[model samples]
Every structure is written in structure tokens, then in C-alpha cells.
Target chain A: MSDPILEVKNLKKYFRVTNGVLKAVDNVNLSIQRGETFGLVGESGCGKSTLGRTIMRLYNTTEGQVLFNGENVHQLKGSRLKQFNRDMQMVFQDPYASLNPRMTVGDIIAEGIDIHRLSSGVKRRERVSELLQTVGLPEEHASRFPHEFSGGQRQRIGIARALAINPQFIVADEPVSALDVSVQAQVINLFKRLQEENGLTYLFISHDLAMVKHIADRVGVMYLGSLTEVAQSHELYRNPLHPYTVALLSAIPIPDPEVERKRERIILEGDVPSPINPPPGCRFFARCPKAMPQCQVDTPRWIEVETDHYVACHLYK
Target chain B: MENILEVKDLKVSFHTYAGEVQAVRGVSFDLKKGEVLAIVGESGCGKSVTSQTIMRLIPSPPSIIKEGSILFDKKIDLVQLTLKEMESIRGSEIGMIFQDPMTSLNPTMTIGKQITEGLVRHQGLSKEKAQKEAIELLSLVGIPRPETRIKQYPHEFSGGMRQRVMIAISLACRPKLLIADEPTTALDVTIQAQIIDLLKDLQEKIGSSIIIITHNLGVVADIAQRVVVMYAGKIVEQGTVDDIFYRAQHPYTWGLLHSILRLDDDEKSELVPIEGMPPDLLAPPQGCAFAARCPHAMNICLNEDPQTQIIQDEHSMACWLMDKRMRTEIR
Candidate 1:
């Protein structure tokens, strides 16, 4: 648990829009252990994607630093930066949009391999076929375009592309959300299998709580560009400390009719407040059911409330 | 209870360049008066096509209705109704709420006009009367400051609020039957809860039967009284909520139930996902659509499409495994 592969310290990624500075990701701090899955769960526009991208060094950090194996990712230069790129990879949300239509499935998967100069000639083709079979696709599928495949198959191709470079870490952003439930299960199982077989670390980001709970060893709940709670998978679901986390968990509709009928859903009132010049205190102060008077004026300090459970709320303080 | 809408032997096909995509094949279901019926299926299963067909919204050039009848209120056949007749019935007799609120609502026009347009056209209310009624409708859908919010355009509202506006627009005339095609699919889970609650409240108050098309089993369990499970453009199972969730018979429904990650599932428990993709509707398989993916598929399942078998009152499935002889053979 102490062997952290990556650490994000006070990371902030902001955009200077016409209206004001859009605080997409503000002062986020978390670390991913070696060979451990860290799940980031949040609503749309909460900056979970921005955080993932920032850590991947796709976006220049506005403040703070991202350390990969105790080395500053943002400060990397020349050969070090190129090595960093080869070490980390990303799987996007939409398989249809992320994949290039004009390119064959083999070319798409081998794009990373070609850039890294990992293999060439017949060897490169062999590697691509191996990747295709690894992701449960036929080796013949290498010649076909992405359009020929189903949504689930297209997603498999996307995963194959990510695994082409054999990166130590992968940021899977809503990887299974676009696929159907049955297909999603298959892809999730594939992800788990890949992690075990390759000893890879993952930053699994999604809006779906149930998916996050299933794949994540440690789960972090984000709201309005800030993390509200971070706990072990079972602990967070069993006893969520943050009010926003409680509401988020309660809001997820359980599939069982009996459970749905009996459970009291804590539907959060109003929409998420604008991230542009967010309120003085807690961002969730307005919609929070258990909001204190101080919550409106003072920001909550991020604290380790329990042995492994961390929360950023005045109530816990 | 009486059925507000009944669809019989419905088949819809889209003539694309590749081939005639049989979007919906012999789908049959009924919605009881004042009851919420959920059509649950994955994308391209014809759930959306079935709902759009109810409003006669499917364009006939590329898409054609091969054969079927959509009987509304036990008197009017929506399938036979012309575009002109559909105009009169749409929003007045039957209304629809689309999946994406962002695209469904007109961006150029104010939400107030969008809501009032339906009331004025459908109910024949005067402009002034419609505007006042629109404000009430807006408030009913839980939009704060309806007076001000109504004046604003669709761009001004959030995703959740825009969906509320869409619901308000749909319910403006208080149609007898409402077809919400994935109404909450685009919104956040918390907002989804709010919209589901609003729909439940409005259904009770308006006494309108609803046909909700969605793939989320959780959403189905939350609001729907009855469930219709579709696969490869055909309904595999139809039953009460309890029947579908607890005692489902179809292999597809079982796969769907087992695939999802349950909140209470054991941490180490592996999901039992259906291995294969849904069969292509272009040249659909000769037999049961789900036979390709079903673990319990028999020789007959691959050769013949099973007839709808009645398990109990209001509980039926179209599966060869449900046959008495097959069940005994399996045992």
C-alpha cells in the first residue's frame, strides 16, 4: 500500500474562459499504489476527466505537481519526457469517436508501437495480432476498419491500442460507460485480468458508482473540481462520511425492485454550482442536506477521518 | 385496469445501404391505464424505434412499417393514422419526452414558447391562457422561478432543467398516454432521481399511462410497474416489475440481471456476462434472437423462433427453454 507509483500533490488545472477562470480541477491530491486500481467517481463537468488528463500530462498543470515514481511529470524534458509518454497511456470514453475511421484496426493499435519504435515489419504485425487476441478479437480483425465492429468490439480495439505500448499505468476514462451492460461486464473483466497479468496500475474514472465500486480498490468521490471523500472500496460504500458522497451513493438506483422500493433515495437538490469562481466555502454547500453555517463561509479541510478513510467536510472536522 | 395502448405484431425496417435493417420485428406489448410500462433493452434493440413508431414519427422513405397496428385508447389505430391525424393526436392524445434534453428542445426559441406551443396547438388554448398554463407546468416539473426561467432559452437551462422543461412541454396538454424515450438517460444520477420522482408525481396527479424506454434496469425497477425486455428487435419477456426482476424466465433477462454490478454483491464475486454480441438485425438469425448468446440454448432454439409462453397472469416469455418438454429434458 505504501509503494505509490504516482502521486498528485495540490494539482490544479484551470482554463481561462471568456467569462472567468473555469476552475476545472482545483487543489486535488491523491496517490495511486503500485498495481492498485484507484477509482475517481464524479458527475459530468466535475473535473474528474480534467484531473485524469492533467495527471497524464495532456494538459499543463496550472499549479502543483504530478510525481511519477518520485519524478515530476511536468518537469520532464527531452528523452525523459518521451520515456514518460511510453510509460503512461489513456483509453477515452467514446470508442466510436476516439478511433480513426480511415485507419485499419491493426494500424490504430500499432500507432503507439510505431511511435515508441517498439517493433517493426512482420514482428509489428505479429504483435498487433497478439494484442487483438488478448482483447478477445480475432486476428483477422486487424485488416477491418473500426466501423465494421460493434460498440463492444470497438471498445476492445480501443483497449488493445492502449495496451500496445505495454505502459505501466493506464488512465481509463469512462471506458465501459458507452458499451451495453453485458458488454461492459466483459470489458471490466478484461481490465481486471490485464491488471493481474501485467502488474499494471490504473486510474479508473467514471460517473457510475457501481462500476467504480467493483473495479476500484480505493475510491475517491469528487464534486465541483474537489475530492470530497477517499476510502477503501468496501469502507466508502458501507460508511460514506461526506454528505455529497452519501447523496451520490443513495442516488444510484439499485436494480432489484425490492431494494429500490424500500430504500430512501437522498436526491441532491439543485444542480452543481458553477466552477467559475466557485463559492467561498464548500462547493456543495448549497445543495448539501447537512450543510453547516460555517460551510457557507469557510472551506473544509481535507482530513483523514479514520484509519484509511479521508473526508473533506466541516461535519467530520 | 384497462390497456391504454396495445401494439400487435409490429415490425419496423430501415432500408440502409448495407441491407434492410429489421429494427423492430414482431414486438407486441400493452400499457395499462395509469400504469408505468418500461421497455428495457440495449442500444439498437428497436426500443426507441418502437416508441417513435407509437407517435408515427418514423420517416417512411428509408424506414417502412412492414406490418402491425398500434391501437391507442382501444379505439384509434396510430399505425393507420396519417401525418395530419398524427399532428392532432400528438401532444394532445399522446406525448413524447426524448432522451437528450439538450437537442430535443429548440435552442432558438424560449422554453416558455416551446411549452405554450403544445398547449395552444393541442388544447386550443389562447396565447395568454397558454402562457399562464406554461408557468404552472414549469413549476409542476420543479423548475424554480418559472416566471423568469420560462423567459430564458434552452441554452440558459442546465441539462437537468432542460429535461424538466421537456417534461413540462410533453405534459402541457396532459395527454392520456406519455412515451418518455430514455428521459433521464442523459442527466446525472442525482438529477435522474429528481426527474423520476417528478414523473411519478405527475403520473399520479395527471392519471396518465406512461411508456418509458430505457436500458437501465435500475431506472426500470425505480419507476416502472411492468417491464418489457427486448433483444435484437423483439421482446423476449414481459411481466410485472417483481416478476421481471425476481422470477425472469428469458436467458437475455437473466444475462442482463447477472451482468450488472450490484451494490450488495460480494467484493470478489465475478460477473456472469453474456459472451456474444446481439445478432445482426440485417440478416437476423432464423431462430430465437438470443440463442447465439444464451448458455442454455437447445438445438430447437437455433432452428425455431419460440412462441410466447404464459408463465402466470401478466407474466410471459418468448423462449424455448420455457417449454415443458425442454424444461424436463434439462432437469
Candidate 2:
């Protein structure tokens, strides 16, 4: 789709430990079109967060490339890399730990501005104030510290900071997971408005399938460090092909009792295998209900099952 | 069906530095014998606090049951129970399963040890007897190879398995009432279903009442016979599963139902999210906590609180719109 805004090719991040190299992120490939929200979902420790951070260049990639705007960001150095940093930013998962306690909300959002040398003196202050307003926070909040605001407000501050650099791409890693559900709505709506206003491409990383369905144009399912499925939001939710995706979707609790009672659940067995030593063949084989013998031996390559819908599972193979 | 636990006019508050955080304004509900009662609310609505309070688990000094009586066994007022009395009731008379199983289970101890520790303390059984019972508990929760798995530590078990172990431990005493606070929120959908079904089957087998505290409505459909919708620490709606699902009254309840993002309803619902944020617990609204966000909010809603009105025989709602008195009769 017009070469996609960002393309991930065999992106692998391995960590050497007492055990052999832990393939925390092994051979994951995904792409996000311009102004589209690509949701990356999996249970905790599935390397979804690592994949997001690596894509954002927060963690240096050990293998593969993150092609941003058709340029391999890892290859860049010095000033060019600094400029690239301004083009992309990250919204961390934990609002409590992500914001600097020492810095004021204004200073936190202004840090990127200061680094990019985007403005001078009062102009930077005005820009920060503008950003705060844009994110639906009061201008007076600029003087307040991160500790003063609620978890949701702090996340908004983080979002404002990401937008400070006038970024084309943003990796929001579980931005609402830490916030109260009431405030989660506020922040999610703010994200939608900002997306429409800024036309930003987002790799929205979350384990919450319902939230993903609400925001994302396309959804990508990750298993142990591999991309198992990717499809348009409606299609994936309606007809989930991958066993992992089906299991994940069945897990989301609906708020209505009638619908909740009627919906049959896909109960996955066993825990996600250790990323340090992911299972041979399909990473989902151990837990997948539809897993075949071949699924335990030959890694299922991701293939297009339908128009714009991809699944990597022996069921389809 | 006999009522196992009846919480009446329960008021809980935390004495924060800011002020007394009125967490549960006055929440009340009942869990019938062998039935499931789901307490649904957004965070800070006091669903968790209400459950924890019944278990006498709310941290004191800051947290206090300012006013109300939590009647368990249809007679015992939990607030009146002493520390020693509450300890006896915790595992044997009333079992509680928390949100995160990994943190709930002792990391250093083997699953067997952790499960048996409670039995040794509460049941006053011998170590050998408790160890034997531990295997049965594990198997009861549907964990495979209970013999080998019990010897492993919490880290060795998967999230779902660890949760199952926690459930087994909770069910060890075979308490008459089980309090599970967001038991499956941390688990994935498939694992969540398995846990829900296991709980349902356990409730049927043990004939113990289940009080599930959660924000997800989907879970209530599977387990709950009656649903209690809480808002800003007060019971906004209470009814049977059918009553609340098909004939939901309160605007807050409506907001919650509509907000649930369904895979099928995506095409039907035109991105209509609930308009406003939850009221600040520090300073809840004077009238209705949700009045600020309610689209149908009238003059009385902003100034005077509306008492709950019976919508059906067993269903009720707390909203100005539901108040027949608020409606004027014109000549």
C-alpha cells in the first residue's frame, strides 16, 4: 500500500543469557500505512513491547532493519539520527515510571523541543503550552510536576511530549493500560482527535483487544516474538484466522451480560513458551488448540489468507 | 436460594492526606447460595474495596468501614468481627482470589507448600495430610499432573496454571462464599474462559456463592446470575442478568453497555463513546456522581440526589430519570 509509512523486515532482537540466546523478538515483520493505527497485541513478555521500542529506535536492533519513510534508521549516525529522533517518538506503557519526577509537565514536553532546537526562549514555552491545550490539558498544568497529575494526565503529558517533536510516527505502548477506565476514554478520544489532526502513523501496542478494535485500522497478533497474524480490524475481529488471535479475542470481556453469556470462548492451554527458547515450528503450537504435528516441527510462514488478511498457522497451511 | 452474603448500607472511606476519600458511598448487594453475583464498575467505583472489605482485607488506618454492616452467613456482621475471628473466616469460611495470581502466590514456596500452608493454619491438619489434600485441590482446579506441578515454584507455572493454583488454594477450605476480585482480568481471552468455566463448575460442585468483582461485562454473562452496577462507590443498578442486559435503566449502565467494543457491533455502533470521564472520587458530584456526564441530566440531577426507584420486582436504578417523583404532572 504505497510502500507503507514504516516497514519491519525480519526484525529480531536477541539477548544472550546464562541460557542460549533468548529470541525475545525473532523474525517479526509488520508494516503500517500512512495515518493508520497498527495494533500489536500479545500477552506480557511476548516481546510486543520490545518490538515497539525497537521500532522506535529506543532499543538498538541486533538484527534486521526498521525502514522509516523508506530509510533504514539504524544505519544513520550523529546529526542525521538526531533529526530522525524528532520524526518518531514513543509513548511508554507505565505513566508512573515514564515521566521524570524532577521535571515539570512543561519541561517534560519541552525536552524534545530543546533537543531538536525547534524554538528559542518564550517561543518554546508557547509551543509547549499549545501542545498541552491540544491534548485537552490546561495551560496552567505546565508548572505542575508529573507527580501532581493522575496516571491518565501523565500519559497525556507523555503524548504531548511525543507530539512536541512534530513526529510523523509514534509508538504508543499500552498508553491506557495504566490509567483508570474512565480516564482511558478521555485519552483514547484525544488520541483519535490528534491522529485526525496530525495525520500521524501509530504502531499502537496493547494487550487489550477491545481498545485495539476501537482505535486501530489494522491489527497484528504476536506470539513469543513472531508475527502470527495481521488483518484489517473488522475482518480480524469477525473472522480471526490464527488460533492465537482467536484465543486472544475470545478473552476480552464484553460489558453486556447477554452477549457475554452467548459468546463461546476459545480456551488456549499452556503458557507462552520461554522467549529464551521459543518452541520449534509455530511459537503458538504448544498452546494452540488447532495445532497439528507439522505445527510443532515446521515454522508456519505468514501467508495472505484473504484480501489484506494474513495468518501464520498450520490450520490455514 | 438462600442468601449467603448480604452487604447492607456498606460505606467505606480512606483517610487520605487530601481528605476522606469516600470510596464506597453506600454499596449493598446479596450473593445467593451456589449463585454468582458480579459487581461491575470502572476503577475507583469501590467494587474491589467492597469485596476486600468483606474479607476484612482493606488496609486499616487509611481505610475504614465508616458505616454499614456486611452480613455473612446471614447473621455475622463482618465489621464487628475481631482480627482473630476474621483470620479464621478468611480461608475456611470465606475464600478470596485476587487479580494477579503470580503476586498472590508465594514465589519462593512450592505450589504444594503455598496451598498446604493455609490448610495447616486454618484446618489445623498435619503437614502430611495437607500435602495429600494439596494434590486434590490442584486436580480439582483442572491443573494437569497435580503431583509434579505442586512441587514447582510459582515462576515455573504458567499464568493460567498459577491462577488455577490460586483458585485451588482459595477453594481448599470449601468456604461457603468465594470472593474473586478481577480474577481473569490479567489473563488472555482463552485462559479467561477456562478460568470462568472452572469457577462456574466449582460453584456448582461446592454449592458456594461467588462474588466476582470486575469491570468487564462479558465476564458477568458467563458467571453472574445477578449483576450489581456501581458508580462512584454506590450501587447504580441491581438486577438479574436478564433484567440488566435487556432492560438496563440507568444512564450510567447504558454508558457501560454501549462502551463495550464488540467485534460484531463495530459495523452497527457508529463510534459513539461515552461522552465524559468518571467523576473525581476526591470530590464526587453533589447530586449524582455521573450526572456531569449524563446526557439526560436535568436541573434536579445537578443539585439534588435521586433515591433509587424499583424498576421491576427484583431490579432497581438510582437516577433522576428513574425517579417518578421528578416527573411533573401537567393539567
Candidate 3:
């Protein structure tokens, strides 16, 4: 659809640990449309964050290409890299740790503007104030330090900072997971509103499935360092194909007591296997309830089983 | 059902440099034997403080139990207990599990030693006997190869395994009351389900009453029979899980239920977020704590505090909207 704003081809990110290489992101391929929110969902340590960081070039890619606007992000240097920085930005998960506690909110938001030379002097200050208002914060809050605000307010400041560069693509890594439920709703709504207003594309990474469903146009479920399923948000939630995705969807406890009592939960048998020197087949073979003999020895191929629905599982094949 | 714990008109405040911060303002609730009660609220809402007070765990000097009595087992008031008396009650009669298992556990020691230390102190078991019991406890919590895992230190265990060890240590003495403060908040959804199931199984076996303090309504609905909704250092509502989920009266509870993006709800329905932040404890409003955020706030809600109105059997809420006269008048 009009050439995806960002594309990842066989992307891999690995960290060298004391014992062995930890394959955090392994041979992942994805594409994000120009103005749609793409959700990446998985449990902790499942490489969702690593994939997001790799896409944003926060971490150097071990093997593969991150193409932004049809240019390889990993190959960019100097002026091209600076241009890439201005075009792509990231909003981190922990608002408490992401923002500098000592800096004023104005300075934090203007950091991007100053780095990209987008504005200076009164214009920069005015831009910061405008961004604060855009994110539903008051202009007066610009003078205050990050420590003076609550978790929700700090997150708003972080969003304002990301928007400062006027980026086309923003990687929001678990932006609302650290927030309270009520505040999370506010931030999610803000994200939707900002997208409509600014025409921005987002790669929204979160563990909260319900929240992700509400905000994302497309959803991808990742297992240990590999994507298991990808589909339209409603399609994925209604009919999850991968065994890991099905178990994960069933595990989310519904709020209504009656429904919760009647629902049959698929409790996965064991914890996620170690990413370091992961098993030599399907990453989810050990915990997948529908696992077959081939699942233990052969890695499943990613296949488009339905219209716009992709799954990497022997069952789908 | 026999009342295992009764807290009446409990008030707690922190004597801080920014003046006395009234943390828990005149809250009260009761827990029955073998019942699972959940305290649901956002941060700074005094849900944790209430649990800490019940366990007699709040640090003093800066913290003070200004008023109210916590009657545990209908035998003693925990508020009046000295540090020595509370110590005797802490691990033996009541156990606590925190959100982060790593911090709660001693990383320097082996998992077996940590679990056995409580047994040795409370049950008067010899080291050898305690070690044997510790392995069994580990197995009970669903840790594989408990015999070998026990000898390894906390660093060797994964987050889920570490939490299981914490649960084993907490249940070492078979405490009648177990307080889990957001036990699954730090774990993954799958791991969270495992922990919740483990707690349910253990509760049935040990016959211990549980008080789970968390912000997740889904978790509360999954494990809790009764629910308490707290806001701005006060309990806004308390009822059976069905009543809270199906027939919630307080506007804050409705806001909370509506705010969350539930998998069962209509995908297109816009989430109705409560408008404002929680009231600051240092300068709390004279009226209802949630009035500022409530969409249906009336004039009386802004000027006067709403008393707890008994809505039905085992259902009570502190909101003017639930008052019979107010409801009739509004309709």
C-alpha cells in the first residue's frame, strides 16, 4: 500500500554474552504502512523491544536491512544519519528513566529541535510550548523539571519530545505499560488523536493485548526472538492461528467475572526457553500445545495463510 | 464465614517534611477465613498502605497509625502490638509477598536457605529438616528439579522461578493470612497466570485467606471473591466480585471498568477515561475524592463528603450517586 514507510528484511540483532551469543532478534521481516499503527505483542524477553530498537537504529543490526523510505537505515552515515534521526524517533517505555530528571520539560522537548536545527531562540521555546499543548500538557509545565511531574505527565513530555522533530515514523516501545489504567487510556487516546492530526506512522510495541487492539491497525505476535503470527487487529484477536498466540490471548484475564468464570484458559505449560542458544527448531515447540514431531526439528516457514494474515506454524501450513 | 481480620475506621498518615501526609483516611473492611479479597487502585491510593498496616509493616516515626484498630483472629489488635510482638506475628501467622521477588529475596543466599530460614525461625525446625521441607515447598510451587534448584542462588533462577521461590518461602509456615502486594505485576502474562493458579491451588491446600493488592481488574476478577476499590487514600467501594464487575455503583469504579480496553468489549467503543488525576493527599478536597474526575458529579458531591451507602447484600459504596434519595431525585 503506497510503499510502506518502513520495511525490515531479514533483520537480526544479537548480543554477545559471557557464555554465548544471545539472539535477541532473529531473521525478522516486517513492514509498516505510512499512517497505520503496527503493534508488536509478546511477553517479556520475547524480543519485542529489541526489534523496536533495531528498527530505530538504537542498536546496530547484526545482519539485515532496516529500510526507511526505501533507504537502508544501517548503511546511512554522517549527514544521511542525521537526516534519518530527524525522520525517525522513539518514545521509550519507562517515562521515569527516559526523561532527564534535572532538565526542564522545555529543554527535554527542544533537544530534538536543537539537534536537527529545526528551530532556535524564541521559535524553539514557542515550539516546545506548542508541543506541550499538543500532548494535552499546559504551557506553564514547560518550565518545570521532570521530577515535578507524575508518571502520566512524564510520559506526555516524552511524547512531546518525540514529536519535536516532526518525524514520519515513531517507535513507541511500551509507552503506556508503566502508566496507570486510567492514565493509559488517556495516553492511548492522545496517540490516536496525534496520528490523525500529524499523519504519523507508529510501531507500537506493548505486552498489553487489549490496549494494543484498541490502538493498532495490524498486530504481530512474537515468540522468543521470532514472529509467530501477523494479521489485522480484529482478525488476529478473533481467530489466532499460532499456538503461542492462542495461548497468550486466552491467558489475558477478562474483567467481567461471568465471562472470566466461563472462559477456558489455555495455560502454557512452561516458561519461555532461553534466547541464548535457543532450541534448533520452532522457538515455541517446547510450550506449544499443538506441537508435532516436525516442530522440534524443523523451523516453520512464515506463510500467508489468508488474506493479509501471516503465520509461522506447521498447523497453518 | 468467620471473620479472620477486621479493620475498623483505620487512619494512617505519614509525618513528612511537606506536612503530615494523610495516606489512609478512615478506611475499614473485613476479611473472612479462606476468602480472597483484592484491593484495586492506582499508585498513591493507599491500597498498599492498608495492606502494610494490616501486616504491621509500615515504618514508624515518619508513619503513624493515627486511629482505628486491626483485629486479627479476633484475638489481638495489630496496631497496638510492639515491634517484638509484631515480629512474632509476621512470618508465623501472616506472610507477605511483594511485587519484585528479587528484592524481597536475599540474593547472596541460596533459595533453599532463604525458604528454610523462615521455617527455622517460626516452626523451630532443625536446619536439616527445614532443608528437606524447603525442597517440597519448591516442588509444590511448580518449580522443576527443586532439589537442585534450591541449592542455586536467586540470581540463577528466572523471574518466574524466583517468584515461585518467594511464594514457597511465604507459605513455609502455613500462615493463616497471606498478603500478596501486586505479586504478578512484574511478571509476563503467561507467568502471571501460572502464579495466580499456583496461589489458588496453595490457598485451597493451606486454607489461608488472601489479600491481593493490585491495579489490574482482570487479575482481581480472576482470583478475588471480594473486591475493594480505593482512591486518594480512601476506599470508595467494596463488594463481591460479581457486584463490582456487573453492578458497580461508585462512579470511580464505573470509570475504571469503562477505561480499560477489555478483549470482550466492542473493539470500536471509545474508552471513557476518568478526566483528572487523583487528588493530592497533602491537600485532599473536602468533598468526595472522585468528584473532580467523575462525569456525573453533582453539586453535593463537590461540597460534602459522601458516606458509605449500603446498596444491597454485601454491596456498599461511598458515593452520593448511590444514595437512594439522590437516585430517585435524579431519575
Candidate 4:
């Protein structure tokens, strides 16, 4: 009913190699509503991360456009670009590698505040202390370096830094994958609480299906460099349409021994094909159990097979 | 099932500049012959250290096995064995599959050479004989075009294929005991499932006892017959898979079960994460190691560690809440 907060239109990102052109993100289209989390999931090297980077304008797009609030994100410059940077923020995967080891926790959180001229001096210090308390960290930890804190605490600092800018949209690339299970739950809960309190939209990127199912409102499944399915999170998990989505969902092992032992897993055969100079047909044709001869030559078109559920597969066609 | 490996009161510590990091503190467990035992724990909990210590792989000086005995096959204390003696048993009698297949494999060596290296040394096979056997081993792990793929280097293989190669190399000598430390951690969910299935299939065919150390509870349930939950370098709970999943008694175990998002779990259920961090191993708590983060910690739990209480057959945990003596105090 409301205008989408972010719209990605036929986006493509490619890298030239000595051998050939590697298609990292190819012809992806997506729309995210305001104040809702859109989860993008795929296995390793599936271009989910590349798509996130491209949407964030970290990488120069090969083709197509990214629209944020009806304006081309790539075309913005000067003060508008600065405003865009403040409005849109990113949370990286590894807190150890992302945060500056030399900077104190206060400095790390205040960097965004100072850059945006949101506060200065004592006010900046006060804001940093407030953020620390918001994320469940002690204010005394502000002066301490990141190395002194544990993995979970460091991640909370990272979240604090992202929240410092008061961004409306955040692209979290595998934010909790590096954390331990108990710590992961804490961080995921933090993300949810922050989203509710800030009225924020998130593009949550991860390879973990269960976490995506738990945190996201809408879910997209990426294969190779293309989206194979998009649906409401519960809808996708309950009745996955695309062959790839089915295989991907079934591959996740349930923690309960009874459920895991009773359920028959759909273990797809063979490795994912190389993204460089990919085949003309469907990317999943090699491993799809329901693949048809036509699927080997013609790529399936993305279509809405049901209300609010989209799939790209000949089986649905 | 008879015991294949018995580790009793194993205390391993690392001498660091800061202090002595007690990595594995008083850990004791046994592996039944042909059974799969999964050691489940987060990082810094010493699951990896415990498994590597079984292989005598940790270098000395920095690491010291302060106390305990690692008895193999009801005799032969592995902790007492010299490096030279351990080498004889390393590949032939015991094998290990490391976490990262990419780095674990030698980049320059061909897959065939890597696989045959163990067969040649441990089995006294000729170069030609070992090479032929290497092809069979690769195919046995479900790798296609074994002859041609064997000649290719590690970089040419994908992550899953490289993991398969690692499995082939580990099973080359058909060791009686295999320790796989996070064998599928680096791979994708699909590849992880494939590797798990491969490990399960091969374990049945080889009839060797396996010690799988991983943080993934799902993978443990999929492959392991028994589970051990570790915290701060010590095991807090251990039981059969059914017991750990259905009737777990430890508060720490409950936290783990509640924290993880199971595939079948409804979205409405909230995760009850453990509140605090694991205790520093350099100066581990005198009480229960999990007491700092545990929700059911009692006054005694802060002063003294609870003894292991057997909740049921083959299921035990170290927690004051499970002790009947503490029930009166709680009332």
C-alpha cells in the first residue's frame, strides 16, 4: 500500500578476469517495503553478497539502477550523497576485521556522529554513552579498546556504530554468522528491537535459512547470480515453490533429533557450476531433479505463481 | 559396544605470556567401538583442543598435558607415547579430518599424491599400488572421474570436492578411530549436508569409532549417537542424542537448545539466549564454569563446582540444580 523504501531494477554486477567475465549479480529485481526486513539468502559464491554491495553502491553496477525513495542511488552526488550515506548504513560480518583495533569503543561509535556533525565534544561523548547503554553494554566500556571486549560485546559495539547515524535502511551482511549460537540470538534480538524502536528497514543478507526465517518478513532465494524465488518468510518456508528453494530449505538440519531423523533430506547432487561464462540455460539445471530438457536451453522467467509468492522454474510454468 | 578410546581426567593447559590458559580442564569421556560421539561446544570451549590432544598433535612447550591418561583400545596410554611412536599409530590406527579443507590440503600436491602418501607410508604399499588404491579411495568418497580428478591439484577442486578429498585422505589407511574436527564448517549448507551424509555412510562401512567435534547441534543430531556439551574447557552435560534433545537436565544445555532456531520451530517462539559470556579459561571459576551465564545458579554454585549427577542411564550433567541435596535449600 505504501511506496517501497528500496527498489532494485534488473541490476547486474560483473568482474572481468583473465579467463572471462564473472557474473556476480545478474539481472536481479527486488522491492522492499518501509520498516520491514527483507532477507536475501544463498549459499557461498551465490552472489548474494555481491547483490548487497551493488545495492549499497559499494560496487559500480554493470547495468540497471537502484532506487531509494524514487531517486537513483547511483546518480546522487554532493550533499544529497552525504545525506544518503547517513540514511543508509551497513553492518559487516566480522566485527574483528571491520572495527579499527586502535580506536576506542567511544571513537568507533562517534565516528559517524562526528562525520554527520550530529554532535560534538561532550555531547558526542554523552551520545556514545547512551548508545552503549542502549545496546546493553556498560558506559565504562566506551574508553576500552575493542580487543578487551569479547566477540558478542564487540558485535554490540558494531551495532551501536550503525545506530549512531540513525539510518532508515541498513544492509546487514551476515551480521550474526560469526557469533556463537547464544550470542547470535542476542544480536538478532538486538536487530529486531532496534528496527522496532527506530522504524528501520533492513536488507538482511545471510546463508542461514533458519535465521532468515526467524528475522525477516520477506525472503528471497539467490542461486548463482539470479533470484529463484521470493515470498513471505512463512510462506516460503511452509510451501517453497522453486526447486532450488525446496532443496535449499530441506538441506537445513533441524536441531531436534526426532525431527531430523524423521525428515527425509533433499540432498542435491554435484557442486554449483562456475559463475564465469555460465551456461545459457537455467543455472540450477545441472542439479535440479525436476529439470526438463527445455530448462537446459531456456532460462525460466520470474512469475507470480500465487498471491504474493513468486518463483522462477519451468515446473511452476 | 566396547570402549575403543578412554580419556580419563585429562588436564591440558597452554603457557601464555598473560598466564596459563587451561584449555582442557579435567575432561573425561570414552568412545564406544564403531559409535559416533559428537563433542558440541562453542569456540574457546576446548572441543578442538580435546580432539587434537587425542592425536598428540599439540606442540609441547606452549602446551602441557598437566594430568591424565589417554588409553587406546583398553591399553597403550597415548599420553605416554613418544612422537615417533605416535607417528606409527597416527594414520594407520587413528586419523583426523581438520576444519578447513582449503588450508588443510597442500596446494602444490596433486590429489592422487596426497591420498597415496598415507597408503604408501602407513600400509607399505608400492608407488604403483598406492596410486591405484588412491583412485578407488576418491571414488569411494563420491568423487566423479577419479582417475583424471586425482591428477589435479587442490585449487582445481571446489570446497565440497576438496572436503571429499580430505575425507578420502583421512580414510586412506582405514584407521580404527577417526576424529573429525568441524569437518563441514567452512562449506555451504548443501555441501554440509552432503559431507555429513558421506561421513555417516563411510563410518558405517568402515565400522570405525568417530569423534566429531562441532558447534552445529543439527549436524550432531544427524550423525552422532551420543553428545557431549562443553563449556569453558569442561563438559557440562553429556548423553545419548535422544536424552540431550528430549530430556536435557542442565541449565546450560537448556540455554543452548533454546537459543538455536530450529527449522521446525514456530516463528512465535522467542529465543532465550544465555545472558553473559563464558568464563575466562586462564582463571576459570572455582564453581561450575557455566554459573556465570546460567539462569539457575545457586549460592553453592558460586562457591563450589557441582559433582556430576547421573540423571538417567548414560545421561549425566554437572549442575547444582540437578542435585537432590540442593532441592531442600531451594525450598
> Which candidate leads the pack in lDDT?
1
For all predictions, the C-alpha RMSD in Å is 1.0, 2.2, 1.3, 1.1
Off by over 4 Å in 2: B268-270, B273-285, B328-331
lDDT of 3 by residue, B263-331 (tens): 866557897787779988998999998988888888999999999878888899998877879779889
Model 1, CA-based lDDT: 0.93
Model 1 residue B55 CA deviation in Å: 0.6
lDDT of 1 by residue, B1-331 (tens): 8889989999999999999999999999989899999999998899999999999898998999999999999999999988998999998889899999989988999988999998878778999999999999999999989999989999999999999999998888889999999999899999999999999999999999999999899999999999999999999999999999999988899999999988766665797788988888999999999988889888999999999989999999999988999889879
Instruction: Encode model 2's per-residue lDDT on B1-331: one tens digit a residue.
Output: 6888888889899998898889999877777788888899888788988989999897798898899998888889899999889888899989989999879988888889989988999989999999999999899999889899889999988888888998999999889989899999888666787898899888888988888988777778768899999988899999998888889989888877766666556663444456656777888888988888899888888998888788888899888876665555321
What TM-score would you give candidate 3 relative to the actual structure?
0.98
Q: DockQ, in order, for the candidates?
A: 0.82, 0.49, 0.81, 0.82
Q: Candidate 2 clashing pairs?
A: A251-B189, A254-B218, A255-B217
lDDT at A178, model 4 = 92
Evaluated at residue A56, the lDDT of candidate 2 is 80
- Candidate 4, residues B220-302, lDDT tens digits: the string is 88889999999988888999999999899898889998999977766547777888888898899989888788777778899
Fnat for the candidates in order? 0.78, 0.53, 0.74, 0.73
Error of 4 at A116 (Å): 1.8
Question: Which pairs of residues collide in candidate 3?
Answer: none
How do the residues A174-235 of candidate 4 rate in per-residue lDDT, one tens digit apiece? 99999999999999999998998989999999999999999999999999999999999999
- CA error at residue B306 for candidate 3, angstroms: 1.2
**Backbone clashes in each candidate structure, one number apiece?**
0, 3, 0, 0
